[model samples]
Target: MSQTTARSAPSKSDIAVVPPRRPSPWRDRLSRLDVKASPYLYIAPFFLVFGVVGLFPLLYTGYVSLFDWELGDDNPVFIGFDNYVELFGDDQFYKTLTNTVSIFLLSSGPQIVIAVLLAALLNARLRMPTAWRVGVLLPYAASLVAIGIIFANLFGPNYGLVNSVFELLGLDRVDWQANRFASHIAIAIMVNWRWTGYNALIILAAMKAIPREIYEAAWVDGASPMRRFFSITLPLLRPTLIFVVVTSTIGGLQIFTEPKLFDAMPGSNNGGSTNQFQTVTLYMYQTAFEGQHFGYASATAWVLFLVILVIASLNFLLTRRLVR
Candidate 1:
């Protein structure tokens, strides 16, 4: 080998050197800012508010129900389910439960049915449609206190339009607030008047959302309007119906204003002359505030809550079945 050739040849240590890689921008950003922590940070306010407002009051109510607490009392004594036991044994509780369920059935059932029918009508082509819809919703937007006062005047035994009409027709005047059935009917009418339009509008929206093509197909198959409504429209509207029924049930179960106002007359505040119009919620109010039995009232509230839960569950199950 020549000396020049040996000098041109590379040694073993003469190798190309590579620089180390820097981290990606995205990776660096992600490392600095965690997505998991960000989500929790965003959701923490809702949880905090719910804990303070919703959960704390519910838990406190339950705790209070276990003790013998009274309004304007200095000390509360622990009773350990005695409030519940006493409630079950009480006649007034049973009466209130019956009244609540009865009013719920009478008011909610008819209201939903009428509302669905009205919604179906409203969804059809009609003149001045916007005006009609706005008029329907007016009742719902009206003040409940105002509604109660209005109904009270209309159903009053004396100097009321209803009794005046009866007298003009030579029919006997009905004592609306004094009679059990009459009082219930009056309350139901008020409830129906207030909520029917709201529910109808909701169902109308649902009915409108249904694809027109389905109705066209039904018509092409020679289905009549009535047949189409029963077979196609109702089936498709089951979800909306379920929603209205469940909500109406909740509202009816918690009926307060109408009965309270009706009973505000002289010799009438215990829900009527005979407690005939008193609902569970009204009963709770009377017990808690008027009667000053806080523990018992808390027990009543819990019972009412359970009833609502059961009804809601049943409604959901039925809805699922109907959908299937």
Candidate 2:
């Protein structure tokens, strides 16, 4: 103890502390911008494109619907809601609207049912699955014009294959183009033929997305194939089913080409001799191009748009509920 020497205190040089770097204003600003604005920037292109192509046209059409904008008019007269008022009162408008709804019902109901059945078949283990899938899609890929022409001939009242078959079966020949209900049925068949397989493929894709474990577990629990499909598959497929139903509703309401080409008279814009099978779109085309009533046609188009919106919404809600 007496021989112990005093120890020197540690100096600052022996334990140096590095100072933290100062944050740059530019870097801070960049970080803030990324956090606040990057998500908006990423989605800006979609909004911009929609504004230009979709929103603009829709608004312009509404604007045009307010005016008396015929084809040859130098100045379109602004008639507020007159076109819509007239459209609501017009008998021809009502006729076409009826036809449109009838055709939509006839086509969409059977189309969905057939598509679901077809999807179920396609989902099963099969020989040459790829070939089967591709074959189903071929009709959708084929030219609409060619299909319309072929169907038109096939359903022709005289000497058509359908009529010939009916005669062979001792059934009276159907005037597909002349009779209103018959025309609707014929066009519905054409629509189903063209679109059922396409919808089936879409549903099949959704089926493939379902987890196999659930299916396997259900099978292990002694669930029949039908039970598994109804209990597990359909419940999970509600979203896809809603999508299919809504889209089919929209497309069915706006049907044009099939009805247009089904007309036997060449270059005729009238749906039939009495405009029996004239759909809303066909009527709009006739009013705009043939009758040159652009404003009226625009009104018709808007009405159709609203109708489709309402029906599609109903379909989505109903399908979701039913599936649940």
Candidate 3:
């Protein structure tokens, strides 16, 4: 073999050719910035709108409350917390708050009881199940204005359905709207009528989520229906019950339209004579619109908001502790 030929054949294997890298489909389809930001973009509109409509008004209202502001003022007088001071000292404020609490207690007890009982009954297999469910929700579906009007007529001082029933039963016809307790009871009855079925539906949904096996085991152990309910159902339903409680308290505290419209006496907007049935919202409206005390009304509103917040927080804590 010649030296030149041996040298030329001395090289090992040749290097293989490499293909250029391909970009990922996802990366190609969307920009890196867009991929990272899509989730935030999707949820931004709700918060943006809320900030515009809800948060701005809330903050502006608080600012307004710090001044002796009213409609048609040349310049709002900056009075730091004086409106709030007056609000706290005012006797009518306390009266309205007291009335609100009275009605809440009176209504909430019967409302919860009726809701639980009805939920339990509806949980059972019935002949006309769909019809029963529909019937239960009918009152809730009715317009609030209509409900108020109908209930007002039903509890009228004279010729009311409730009084007529009492007359038939050889009982004295009690004045519903005249007496303090009676007025509370009438308002409570209306609240329960409008709300019981709605609460029942929530409870029923919770009940249905309970495992059938647990009930079966209890039944095999000779637990009565009521026993199983107390032992198995109620214990399992604590979370849902807490949710219902918080929501109900919040809603009950904010009740405005029902009482406003339900007063049988024409053109009565101050809740009742001497503010017997007045809620905080009603008082605030009356103060702002009727009395034209804008700053004071705004202060009243802030105080009411704080009160509701504190109460709801305490309720949540207490109930959570009880459960644990």
Candidate 4:
């Protein structure tokens, strides 16, 4: 038997077709504008602040370096490169440069070594690790002026704790303030003491960020702690080491306060009895304020800035090569 199936009639709503709504030009334009302009608006404040405080001062210093400007001088004479020329010829400038480099060398190498060692120690399992890490940073948080004073007294030639220890060991007391190299050593000690812990914390953070799986595999392969550190950890820490080294170079070269305050001799502002430990910054301060050679001091500052740039670049290159 054949059966016929009846179909139901279609409703008006089912036959009707609805077209897509047209895009709003203003809304589309506003969205596109927001996408394009949002990033710049967010970042504008930083550039504005930097232009006012950082870039303007840097450019102004460079401009002032080309003049024969002095402190309290209303009408400054425009002399092109005269200050730089004079700076190159100045014996005192060369001496200060030497002292700056010397102190930097004394401090930077040992500081990095100690910082790495401390980081390694701190990365190990220990009781109250947070307390230990915070304790290490105390010296960095302390006042620089106080650290300088305490170190100065400790390094004093006579009646200082360091000298007393030397005498106890049957060695003659070395005059840290009067002697140039000794004074550099003393300043370096202070720099290392203050900054090593801070650097160690930075390095420890880097260490903590390294993947644990790699270390676990190395352990399964019978690698010792020292082996794992040298092979896995040190290689992974390259970027952090580069940052630490570059910053240390900059800070070491610009050292002023420690040497300035470490000089315990009465009425001596020249870094020592004969300007023995005077760094570039100390000399620049003396030239600008005491001798009223603002132009010359600006020239000195520019030169030091260039030197720091070059050295920091070299450090980055060298570290990149050595780490690999």
lDDT of 3 at 306: 89
How many residue pairs clash in each candidate at the backbone level? Answer: 0, 0, 0, 0
TM-score of each: 0.87, 0.90, 0.88, 0.91
Cα lDDT tens digits for candidate 2, 236-307: 888989999999999999999999999998767789999999999999999999989999999999999999
TM-score: model 2 vs. ground truth: 0.90
lDDT of 1 by residue, 125-164 (tens): 8999999999999999999888988989999888889999
Judge candidate 4 at residue 225 and give its lDDT. Answer: 90
Clashing pairs in 3: none
Ranking by lDDT: 2, 4, 1, 3
Against the unseen true structure, what C-alpha lDDT does each candidate score? 0.85, 0.91, 0.84, 0.90
lDDT of 3 by residue, 1-324 (tens): 445654676433311222146446676667776888888899999989999998998888899899998876779999999999999899999998988888888887678778988989999999998788888989999998888888889988898999999999999998877777787788888888889999999999999999999999999999999899888988787887788778888888877876787676665678877778888888998889888888999898899888888877877886677654
Question: Which residue pairs show backbone clashes in model 4?
Answer: none
